[model samples]
Target: MPEQFIAEESRSIGHAGRRELIAWAFYDFANSGYTTVVQTTLFNTYFVGVVAGGVGGVSPGLATLLWSLSVGFANFVVMFSAPVIGAIADIKACKKRFLLWSSIGCIVSTALLAQVGPGDYKLGMVLVTVSVIMFAYGENLIAAFLPELVPEEQMGRLSGYGWGLGYVGGLLTLLLCLGYLHWAMQQGMGEAEAVPVTLLITAVTFALTAAPTFIWLRERARPLPEVSGERILAASFGRLRHTFREARRFRDLIRFLMTLAVYQSGVSTVIVLAAVYAQQVMGFDTQSLIVLIMVINVTAAVGALICGHLQDRIGSVPTLAITLAIWIAALLAAYFAEERSQMWIVGNMIGIAMGASQAVGRALVSKFSPAERAGEFLGLWGLVNRLSVIVGPLSYGLINYWSGGNHRLSLLSTLAFFALGLLLLSKVDEARGRAAANNFLACGDS
Candidate 1:
């Protein structure tokens, strides 16, 4: 919307038209507030500390588990629905439309979260679930645009651009909310009053910031004529079944998705629980938590930009493998972190690994997806990711609960996922996956 923002993506990094690319990245800017504030930073702590804090004799450990369950339940719904809706979007050529609606759903749901307060954990959980489901769908639909915007080799850079800009956006939004929170507290209001205002800020910023995306991000997909006069719902299912039947042709993609599902669990765990960990274990208050995340956002953006370039030069599999290794190291540091200084270092490491891993993974998936089948294939990607979200966060919660609130033990368990993912990454053949997608593009399997 602003010239300064437009100039931000004009550095000629991503190999795409600057305007469209900037607009696409703006969507990332728009949605980052939802994840950064509502999921990762503020409301999670609110849900755990304020919303679920000591009410009805709910233990802190149980509250943490409940938060994890809320996230898991949301992903569980998306796991089954993502592919079907994505297939429908593909057949109808409405990825952008789907993206818009999901954003609106998330914005509205987030605004409604202001209605939640202390002892309203049930309502808070439901609203968050609705918001997250919308956010996940929007994430999938926006990512499906990747292969259309650039060639496979450039996908990493494009994905990185969006994620890098996204962190900047998240940082800015957090700062804005932080300023308000600080002012409110100075004026004698506490979290219960100030937190609702921050949610409103997030909703408004999400709306205004997202305007550029709908204004400039064009949908390049065309509706399939073969599906004419057919029920899109049935055709969507049929397409999914057909894709399943022909999975052999895309074995490399299958292999990579399997690898992604394993390691992304660690990513998911950190994303949903990082703020909780910082608060509960490291004793970060609200202001301190915001600052820590802001710092992490900076490193995450740098990691995305650097790793994006590396992926194009060396290859996606190796780059992703390297990031997963970083994740293991980060987790080990987090597990042993006793001092706040050590936790900050751990946070930065996690941020770097997160940016690199997520950007490369999305780009790799795009490299293996044909343009015509982008939505369906990326939908499958969404399915695998959301499924992993369920497994990672829920299991971590269970471990915490069963171990009598031993968060360190629960966090340490995530190391297994990154290790498993790194091992699985070696099984992926990047070159073969790209060729398979190219072949499918030329000779339509339909």
Candidate 2:
């Protein structure tokens, strides 16, 4: 290629045009309701106390075990399949198409959760698994859009902007659900009746909020020639194999992913269990549980927005390291806290750590990804994170079960994950990784 074209392409490297960036971030706003309502607060408790207990009369311990195992299974599926699907999306230039179908899958399944009631634990489990799978796919698909929207320098801010807004979305959804739950109980509805309605509310929120993403965000990658039809699957695997064979080029990405896997395990565990801990350990009832989560969302939004700017100035690794240290400290505080007031402090700390760590990790992956293979690589990032989701919750569930429901002891597992993550983070070289990604775009792809 001529030097003129290289110069022009370099000049074109900046933020997305028009409202594309806003639309992209709004997708985060759209999907967060599912995780907030279904995964974290309402449904998990309802599933354990009502659905699992109704027919066969499952032990609460066993119900939690089942819930954790189910979460593990769903993420396990995403863990192995995300890379191949991502590779396909890149080669087909159909990231939007794939995202749309996954969104539909999640919305439909999530709404169907309203149909679950007493004696419907099996149905609940199946729907939960399907919704989670769809949600994970959509999350990875939308993140693949990140590298297309901004240059590496702005990635942290953009990523942080989305996460911060996402927490607000989560907060709003929880407030709506909390209000409805309160009204339902006032109308003489019990937990069984009120909880399923919240699931429906979450589904509707996701669909309505996600529309702008499909309408406004453009698919920028051109499809690779001959990588269509039946060959798409073959090409996806081929791409994965090629990526692995080129391991030397992406060594830092590999290292950082290992770091992410460890730390995000801790994060995922907190997300999955926070409500349960509040309810059981902190003695929070439903209304109080919802309020606690609302506080977390507020703190998380602040952390994401503030640390995003900090990351741009100080670099991603340092920002991530700081968050991990916070996580370890928060876990220790949580373990020792005997009062609800103390747990509230610990919850806010976890929220801040959670938002910053997640935002920095996403932006750092964007820094390391080659432009043409952004989808495939972020898919790999999803793969590693999903695997952590499996390990994190399952480990916590097992500890809780083995220790006779001792949640305090189980909290130690999250602290260990953070410690391991911080150590592994030191091994990654951000500058070298960015240069390698740029060199590929400049020389290999061109």
TM-score of each: 0.96, 0.96
Question: Candidate 2: global Cα-lDDT?
Answer: 0.89
Candidate 2: list runs displaced more than 4 Å.
1-15, 54-56
Report the lDDT tens digits of candidate 1 across residue range 39-144: 8999888888888876535788899999999999999999999999999999999999999999999999999999998899999999999999999999999999
Error of 2 at 329 (Å): 0.9
TM-score of 1: 0.96
Give the runs in model 1 whose Cα sits over 4 Å from its true position. 1-16, 228-230
Q: Candidate 1: RMSD over Cα atoms?
A: 2.8
Q: For model 2, give the 10-residue run with minimal summed lDDT.
A: 1-10
- Per-residue C-alpha lDDT of model 2 across residues 360-406, encoded as one tens digit per residue: 99999999999889999999999998999899999998998898888
